[model samples]
Target chain A: MWEQIRSNQTRTLVLVVAMGLLLLLVGYFLGEAIFGSGIGGLVVAILIWVVMNLFAYFQGDSMILAISRARKISPDDHPRLYNVVEEMKIASGLPKIPDIYIIDDPSPNAFAVGRDPSRASVAITSGLLERLNRDELQGVMAHEISHIKNRDVLLMTFCSVLLGTIVILAWFGSRMMLFGGARGGRRSSGGGGGYATLIIVAVAILLMILAPIAAQLIYYAISRKREYLADASGALYTRYPEGLASALEKIAGSTQELKTANQAFAPMYIINPFRSKGRAASDLTSTHPPISERVRILRSMAGGASLAAYEKAYQEVRGSGRGVIPPSALVGETPVAARKAEAVPAEPGKVERARETSDLLWKYSNYGLVNCECGTKLRVPPKLRGSSIRCPHCGRVNPLSSRP
Target chain B: MDCPACKGVVVVVEYQRIELDYCTKCYGVWFDAGELSLLAERLDLRGAALDVNQIAALPEKKAAEKARGCPICRKKMKKVTLGSAPEVLVDVCTRGDGLWFDGGEVGQVLGQLKDKGAAADEQGRVIDFLGEVFHVRG
Candidate 1:
């Protein structure tokens, strides 16, 4: 396990340095076009990298939450969700119950973010909460909690930043080469070493075009491996692989787009938020291991929900242990008895369930929930006139504005 | 978000995975453009599918006259009937911001979709898995 962590650390460092060198090289060549020298571009590239890193280190989670329009929720506001989060926190032995956030989007998805467990936050789309029952929700939260415990969140944070910068630098370099290179190219061509200069320029341009893509591939590689580990760890923590496996089914089946999701950050999610159905994991552009493959592995686990069980299932499914779960990261656990069918209640009817779900959301948003005498319940928004509301059910006017 | 019908404070609501704004004062609900479709599709009702394309193709029963301003952008919203049953007349924002349903109207729309969607759930593999895993018998 220690070796696995060490290898991950080494790989992350190598990936970042490789990306940085790509940025520096592309900057140098594009710098040549703009300033007739690579020095200025190299300096700017370094500055951007430093500044972006500083920003990401300090404000990355906040920035991500803000962009996703995720809002913090009080425990009292959504006890059901808060309870689930607290359960995972205890099970994972995380120092603090990570802050919980809710994005308004109707897409079923969830993710965790922070440099470490103490500062971490878990954000789930409203859609996910409405879709998953309590145990399923527990499974999903467990996955994110495992991510926090494993420091995968921190690692991905670093990778995402590096990927962003490399892509930006390459884009800026191409634009500069196109508009600013005519004079520089002409002057270099007039020199005695014209052909050599031309070849250097060609190679620089080619590298600039490919650098961003190369950085993304590396980013995806690291991200994909971490996801499987989180799944395994999460199942171990919950002692219910069925919970997460079932949750994945619900998440994968949803077609709604998470309106606030940015494509680059899709890796942080439990499932690929933007992934279309049936996309193979072997696709270089995939941000997650295939959902079908993952679900199959989770279901295939026998014995207890130990890391060993997960590893064995992974080996059977993937045909090799390779990079799915890092070697030795799995700790043995006493597998609890399989939960009895009657131990968990069947879900309520759709209308009742929907009403309960709406009440949950409304309570968090400070909306008033009142049941009419005619049996119709109303969710009143905080901003509206809290006055007389006619029941669409019985056509009897209910006095709601009487409340101060 | 303000309620389109009663101009009262609106609260957010969710069902399945689809979220909409509901008014406290008038009990009206709002579904952003594409949200209704999203909600319907998420319900995954196979028999009586109420997709966006189906709703768009419905004959304009009510004209665009007296269009209400969009709650988000306040543009004049066009009125359109929902579903094949020609159910509630939803005031749709021309800018595609969302649709406005008077109090109880959302219930009507969802109730119908749910009926159709219910038949489809009989074969849902996920639900079957949940039943097996959780020990729910149907």
Candidate 2:
């Protein structure tokens, strides 16, 4: 494990340095065209780029949060969620507690942002809270905390920014070569080296186009491996690989799409938001290991006392006809089969009605409430409200103001 | 525009010919749903937060108008107001369906409710202290 971590560290460092070098090359080439490559001009352009990127680094959290429509929650507003995050923070030994944010979207996803744990924030969608049980929720939360613990949040952000700059430079180079070069030639009255300049510009454009993409493939490779590392570490942290594995299954099963998501925030999710379902893991372009593969690994981890036993058991479990029960179900005192047999019928229309109510409440609550029985104290799903809820404890449903 | 549910004002900001309606407090957007997608085809549109203000000049008849059923509950929904802010009343379905916020109302309603909760906490503390002095527990 240590050897793998060392290898991963080496790989990530190489990728970051490669990205940096790519950015520098693109910057230099673009700079030479815009401002003749005197030492002073080069310095001035590089300085400006660095200064601007630095500003983005400091304010990036706020800007991203706002753009994503994530709203902040105080501990007073969401005690359970606040407490969960607090516990995770302590367990992970983070210097400061990250702020929590709630997105109204119904997608079962979460992400961490900020330059590091000290400045980080975690955001979860209402759908995630609604769908996941307490243990499953813990598993997912642990995975995100693992990202913070491993400093992947900072690393991914830096990689993304650098990659973005490279892409921009590439685009600028292409646009200039296609249009600007001809104009430049017109201005220079067909100078002897004009065609040579055009060829350089064309080659520069091609390199520029290819550079960022190549850099991003490297970025995704590093990012994907970090996810696998976080998954392993998170299971270690919670002592329950099945918990996260089950959570991932639920996340996979959920059909609700995240409305606020774009390519930029896609990598931060526990599962890739943009992933096409049913694709095989052997396809290397994927930003995440295939869900099936991840679940298989986790189930293997859950099957035995030692990692070797886990591997052996995992192979058997995969090969044998026995389907792995969800970790939560398996962890319960009773066998899941007995529980299934003992399960009560849905009281006629009750299940259907509840499903309907759940959907309606889900959309209206911005997917916030889970089991709001009119006679029960409007039971919301546990955690992640970013606000307080009323109980139907007395069977007297209190009218809540929509204004508030 | 005010959120029909919360009565918080919604603001329309213009960049060129396009207009967007956004709520300051709740951050919920009001468009004809897919209209924004169409608008995004040409313009670089993003949300701009608005500040809440009740439209005092609107007729009281609009205030009296009630939605027929809770959108989520399929049952009657009630309009309730926070004690601290009598002017703002929200129609909470409470039956596990969703609560509606007028286009601009979500923020004010949520903000005022938070303040009301803080006030309630203080009052509860005082009441508990008085109960201790009086030995009121059965």
Candidate 3:
């Protein structure tokens, strides 16, 4: 598994280099067909892409955060969450503490964004804070921190910028073809022209049609591997895969679509924004693996299993009939291996139980109004005001007041 | 000076009262958030509510002010737009507490929310009707 992860990283690095060379080669050839292989024009386009993409990459964080209406938080405002990040940062050996931001969204999701660990930030929805308990929160935070520590954020952003450049270039090339590139072609063709113009136009069209999809595929492959890497690294940080496993369960339950998230930032989120499609279990086109597989892996890690055992278990679970579990409460001990096997030959009654438990857990985590005073937690509904309640442990009469 | 919605806490900065009633999750401003209350009291609620659908037409501009911590932001909220509709502007605490709606903006925002709720219901009904109508044809 270690060797696979290492090899994957090496492979992705090589692919990035190969992609750049391929793009340059194509650009050079196309430039020749139109401009008679003028190195100046080819060089100019490369320079422009480098300049524009660098500028976008540098400012991308602020732009994305502003669009989401996320607000920065100081450690004083959210101490527990701050502490969780601090712990993860220390464990991950990251030099600086990443800034924390919270989206005022009532959806359970979090994503890490930035060019690198030093510049990176993690944003979690208010729903995540309200839904997951301390340990689970740590699990989720650890996952994001893992992304940063592994430099996945930087790699992903670079991939996006490169992909965007390819798309823009393709679009421009297509526009030139339709509107007449022959006019421009004449200037550099040295009057040996018509055949060069036709070939250039045809090839330009071909590249334009194929580049974006190819870029997208490359981006997805990189992204999916990074997610797997992060999952593994996150487990190493928390040393309790169940924390993340349970967090995934809770998040998977809601299925409330994020209205604000668009495709550009959608891939960064823990779960897909289009959860309403009942696509939680399907990893059809997504770069990220299925949440069920992630949960299964995490659970196995939590249960103190070897990596080989986890791999075997994961493959077994995937082939079997059991689909992803919806949001369920963490009540008792459920080992990863056991869950994977149970998922394999899921009994009819157990499937019903999984659904029921998930529904219950979702409700308990979301709508329960728990107000703690003197460390005693009281869960009350909106209508239960003015009721005389006693603390379970302290024997003190705790009257419910709307003001509090 | 008193915030009308949650009535939890209020802070006075620059001789203006700022109230906090905003929930962290929903990020919806509550009535007690200062300028909103003043605006609501001065304006006609029914008229403001009727104009709710036009809330998106409001203008927003950053106001020049020195730092004075808002009870919500726990840091000074630079005077930001309070109402997006009927174009009322107010001070907002940076910390996401509550917004201070100027004059009639609060009532207008409430009115807009009501209109939105109604619009949503109307849309739902249309969809349901279409579904039923299409069901018979299919």
Task: Give the Å shift of residue A380 in candidate 3.
Answer: 23
Residue by residue across A176-243, what tens digits does model 2's lDDT show?
65666534345346566666556544545566777878877877877777777677556655556777
- Model 3, span A1-404: residue lDDT tens: 23233333456787677667656755655555545554754685587569766876788888878887777878766677799999999877778899988776545688888877788889887656656766678889988987887777777777777776776666666676567554446653566566756666667567668876777777766677677667665665676667788999988766445546766565677766655455545544576677877887666543543333344445455666432211121123232332222232532232232223222332333323333354434443343334554432244555555323
Per-residue accuracy of model 1 over B32-136 as CA lDDT, tens digit each: 644554444445644433443334344655654345677876666666765345256767665445567665555454445434443333223222221122121
What tier of docking accuracy does candidate 2 attain? incorrect
lDDT of each: 0.70, 0.54, 0.55
| Candidates' chain A TM-scores | 0.89, 0.71, 0.70
Sorting all predicted structures by TM-score, with the top scorer first, yields 1, 2, 3
TM-score of each prediction: 0.77, 0.57, 0.56
Q: Where is the poorest 10-residue window by lDDT in model 1 chain A?
A: A1-10
**Model 2, runs deviating above 4 Å:** A1-8, A32-49, A182-190, A193-199, A277-285, A302-404, B1-138
Writing each residue's lDDT as its tens digit, candidate 1 over A1-404 gives: 41244244555567667766777887787676556678987888778888888888799999999999888988886778899999999988889999999887667899999988899999998778877887889999999998888888888887787788778887877777787664467877577777767776776778787888888888887888788888988887788888999999988876666778898678889988885656666787888888888899889886458776787888899887454554445433344543422455665533444455556556666776655564445556665563666544355666765332
Interface RMSD of 2: 21.3
